[model samples]
Target chain A: MRGKYLLGILVILGALGYMVFGGLGRNLVYFLTPSEYLQDQARYQNRSVRLGGLVKPGTVQYDKDRLELRFVLTDGVAEVPVLHKGTPPGMFKEGQGVVVEGRFQEGVFQGTNLLVKHSEAYQAPKEGWTPEEVRKLIEEAQ
Target chain B: MLKTQTPSRPDALTWVFLGLGLLLLPLGLYLALAAPPDVNQGYLVRIMYLHVPTAWVGYLAFFVTFLYSLLYLFRQDPRHDRVALASAEIGLVFMGLALVTGMLWARPTWGVYWTWEPRLTTTAILFAVYLGYFLLRGAIEDPELRRKAAAAVGVLGFLNVPISYMSVKWWRSLHQTQSIDLTTGRIHMDPAMLQALLFNLLVFTLLYLGFTRFRAMVAALEEAKEEA
Candidate 1:
């Protein structure tokens, strides 16, 4: 009985200690905005971290090959330039929310991957209406 | 009918284990912090000292659970069931530590806290599966059924552990593969940093043994109360 009891206590304490002081404890996750990235430029110079926010309007520039792409990520206060050497997601566009993954290098946010936030709202076509009928009904309603 | 003699508690062994743990703390601290940074990755490499060991111990804890869970099912002893439950709980805690540390390490190394890559996704799934193990235990009222059901799930859930570890090599992903290769016996690290990691691993393993023993004791007491 005593043997079992000792085992139980050991397991619990071990788990707690591993979480609190272990290497895992030191590297807990935190998010950074574009403004914070800019404000702490010197501090974050070469460190890798996630930068999340909306894509700045009119900042997206895509090469004809669709492989090399450029855009600006913004948190409303500041904008950071993003360069990706991959195909952008179909849903990726200007003014959309996006998160880029890569290190900050030479004043650019080089993204190896891009994740585009999809809109949730859904609009239904009018009941019993064809494409032409829908146009005619909109004109009649106006 | 003759009564069997009760096994004596190994007080000396317990003291020895505790002493070893105390000695390990200073050595682990030195290796984790006092050691110089790597010439390549710099200080961020230090995270490996903690993350890797936590991951190793998490697997060890779960393996204990799997073994004890089988014992409970086959022997139908409540003592075995208690030990299995205690191990599972400890395993969950270590798994959480591994995930948290992995995220922290990722922030500086991989540049993101979360990703849908194979290893990350599978690890998240492993965490959720164990979490579901606890929830399943809570949902059941019958002690015998709870033990059997949880044991089955425990065995099945462990199947993902290897998958999580190997996903990086199996598929292309942004997540970095393992740092150490046992067959090659070559560590891509400075000698001092390697020493630190090895020291920390020993300390964490000792710490793990001590904690597991303590938790098992508490579980035994709880079982005795239930039986009484």
Candidate 2:
């Protein structure tokens, strides 16, 4: 009985070990950058893909009435224009790192979802700073 | 058979841990609330007080299970098996808390409650593996076979813990990197926030210790009843 149980354990562990480690490469690329996607545009044209990069500073165009946001996402080497509908997240801003999920249509990426990619750094606002000043500091830092 | 029998009741140290942790929990919350807001996320950052500690306990509990599972295999002792079972159960609960809190934090910050990012996917897998551990335990009828199978699971399933923890760094996931990087021992958080996070961690650790001991005692009682 003990030997039988041991064999069962070995089989299960082997299968799980393969599932976890063997798929490492695919899992490692959770999202692709603009540069990566641009390199092989035809492969991702029809399928839904997640594109990650920085929101270009001067390319943001938002229509609050229509809840439409348009911007150029860049990876310093390549850029992809993105169009997302709905209110942008609180942390979403120009020059911020972001990941958007959707498919490429023509040249623009039609984003179904947008996510802000924050950094690990955590700093408190400087003492006695006005809200306006704080906003300025945030944009300036970006 | 050679190891000491499992204690049938909670010990003094167990009570002490429970008491101190419960007593300190409110204070920990207070510190989290009072901690200076983040320049970026503002009050939203307070969620880390609960999220980080719960995840830490989940990792710690699984590590304890892994250690005890090995001991059970070598010594053929029921006591180690019971401890391993209790720790894995608690680890699952704490890991669930971590996932829930993370989702809540993500909804407003990341614009979604959940995503199929590397870190999230790996954590979900880790949770499932432990759930499988319990299922494996329940499927076997003979006490010896059950313990042996569960111990094997407890040992092997823990591999996902490290994988889950490192997924964010190993992959370019949407999840932020660790503020307190365990690898480099460098902190990127403000001092006030750090103090609050550390205090919460201490309280949660104490609670986990107490809960594991208490649960192990209960497991011993259940085994005794089964034998009778």
Of the true interface contacts, what fraction does each candidate have? 0.00, 0.61
Q: Write the per-residue lDDT of candidate 1 for residues B1-228, one digit (tens) a residue.
A: 243332334345555665797788887877687665432234555677788888888877778878888888789876677667777787788888988998887664444577665666667667766776776676666888988988987788788788777766675445656656554554555566677777877877777776776666676666555655
Q: Count the backbone clashes (under 3 Å) in each candidate.
A: 23, 0
For model 2, state the Cα shift of residue A121 in Å: 1.3
Q: After superposition, how far is residue B40 of candidate 2 from its true place, in Å?
A: 0.8
| TM-score of each candidate structure, all chains considered together | 0.60, 0.90
- Candidate 2 per-residue lDDT, tens place, A1-142, comes to 5456556656656655655676444556878999999889878779998899999999999899999999999999999999998888888988899999999887789999999988889887888776567667666653
When candidate 1 is compared with the true two-chain complex, its DockQ is 0.02
In candidate 2, the residue pairs with backbone N, CA or C atoms under 3 Å apart (3 or more residues apart, or in different chains) clash, namely none
Task: Report the C-alpha displacement of residue B109, candidate 2, in angstroms.
Answer: 0.4
TM for candidate 1 is: 0.60
lDDT per residue (tens digit) for residues A4-120 in model 1? 534554554465355435523332332367988878878877877667788898888989676888999999998889998886664466787776778877788888767654331
All models: lDDT? Answer: 0.68, 0.88
- The TM-score each candidate achieves on chain A is 0.65, 0.74
Alpha-carbon runs more than 4 Å astray in model 2: A1-27, A128-142, B1-8
